[model samples]
Every structure is written in structure tokens, then in C-alpha cells.
Target: MKKSIALFIILISVFSLAFNSCSSDDDESNDPQVATGSFEIYLDGVLFKQGTNAEVGLIKDNQGNYVNTVTIGMGSETGIVVSGFPATISDVTTMDNDSDPGVNINVDSDYYGTISGTMTRTSASKISFDGTCTKLMEAQVYTITGFVQSTAWEVID
Candidate 1:
């Protein structure tokens, strides 16, 4: 009887140790990565400024769904950011000043207006957007066009 009890305890200990072992592969796979992209801003059909390294991220909406966001520039500097939650490929997502939907492109420059664009996924890790923005600020009318591409966007939040 004592021998059988000892054998059962040994088995239980071995099982516990096996279950508690940590796997590096599993841990690394679960980690989130940052998304990156690039864009060029054109003012009145002329190239005004551009960014080679932009940051793209995923944001969760109230419905617990993921939305893709593209952001460029800094807090104090001229910046342009847009968010689109495309359900499928080639879906045109739009953002405007009056609409103010969560999924909209926001221009934070001296000129701010309605930015309408479409986001297309070219590959599993790449995306491209073509859009036009028109804004009238300080009695000056500005028309801008943007061509943006994702350089590196494969992050999970």
C-alpha cells in the first residue's frame, strides 16, 4: 500500500512540473508589434512635405473590433492622421470635418478640411491609400492630395 502511494505522488509531481514549464516560442508569438507606414502630402497639386517612417496602429472600438489607424508627424509640428476600419479589401473609407466619425482622416495643420480616401491592402504586411483633402483656413483655400503606403505594418495590439 505504501509503495503504491509513493508512486502516485511521484507521478503527480512530474505532471505538475511538466505543466508549469514555460515555452519561449509561445511567449514570443503572443507579443504585440508596432506597425509603420509612409506618406507624401501635396498642396495644390504640388508636393509640400513627406514622411518616410510613419506609425500605424490598431485601435479597438466600442464593439470590441480592431480599426487600423495611420498617423504622421509630431504633437507640436504639422501632422496628418487618418483612421479607417475597412471590412474588406478595396473598401473606400472617408473622413470629413463635419461628419467627425471615428473613422476619418484628420489634418492638423494650418489648413484643415474634409479628407476623403480609400484604403487598399496590397499584401499581408502592406497597404496603400489615395485621397484628396480640401480645407479653408484663415480665408485661404488649400487642396491637398496624399499617397500613402505602409512600409511595415504587422503589429497586434
Candidate 2:
């Protein structure tokens, strides 16, 4: 049973890896220079036991630097265990603003998110902020609870 579950997780990760970059109708900037880099996502904040599926991409910073845009995708990863399943996550959710930090690619999700008191990394790569965005029909309040030792990512490519 454990082996089967692991295999299933691996399959899901590989399948998700084939996806294309997010849609940006307009990706034009007047930056002076561009530097490029790579990134990787780890599970439970463990670089060694990272999620089977991680997000890797490049970015064009304002300074004309083209860096790899890395993020944690919606799926099962090491250390994070979803309730009611051996190891699986069902949907993917993302949030982004054209601006930087809180306004730019914060990428909140629904499947599993950072618990409160816990924090997620905002764009620019150091600060942590809300990524688990929720919608309340009546109250319209998003209670974001982050995780402890959650997804730890680094720029590696």
C-alpha cells in the first residue's frame, strides 16, 4: 500500500511537470538589465525531501535580470499530508498582481495552503506573506492559516 501510494504521487508529479508557464497577456518591461537563475521546491521545508512536483521558471526583474521563477505547485509533496488521502491533492489555485512583493506573484492556493502564524514567501524571494487565499460568500473574509516547516524553495534550476 505504501509503495503504491508513493508511485501514485510520483505519477502525479511527473504529469503536472508538463504544464506550460502561466498566462501573461502582457509581459513587457523597460528594465535595463536581465539576469537568469533557477529554482526548486522542497517538502516540509526539507530540501532533501522536496515535493515530487515543483515549479521552475524564469523571470525578468526590473533590473533587467532574468531569473528562474520557481514556486510550489498544487500537488502532494514530502512532509505535507492531506487529510482523507494517502498522498494526493486535487486542485490548483494561484494569485498574482502585476506589482512586486505583496502585489506581484504571491501565488496563493486552495488545495493546501500556508497556515496562520506561518508565512509564505512573496516575490523578491525573502519576505513571507499570504498565499492561501479564501473567498467568503457572505462575510468575504479569507482566513489564511500557514504551515510550519512547509514548502522551502531555492533558486537552482
What's the number of clashes in each of the models? 0, 23
For candidate 1, write residues 32-66 as lDDT tens digits.
22434566766677877676655433444578554
TM-score of 2: 0.27
TM values, all candidates: 0.51, 0.27
lDDT of each: 0.44, 0.28
Question: What TM-score does candidate 1 reach?
Answer: 0.51
Q: Can you list the residue pairs that collide in candidate 1?
A: none
RMSD of each: 19.6, 15.0
Encode model 2's per-residue lDDT on 8-124: one tens digit a residue: 354334324322333343254321111222233332344322223333333335784433333333322322221111011222223332111111112222222222222333333
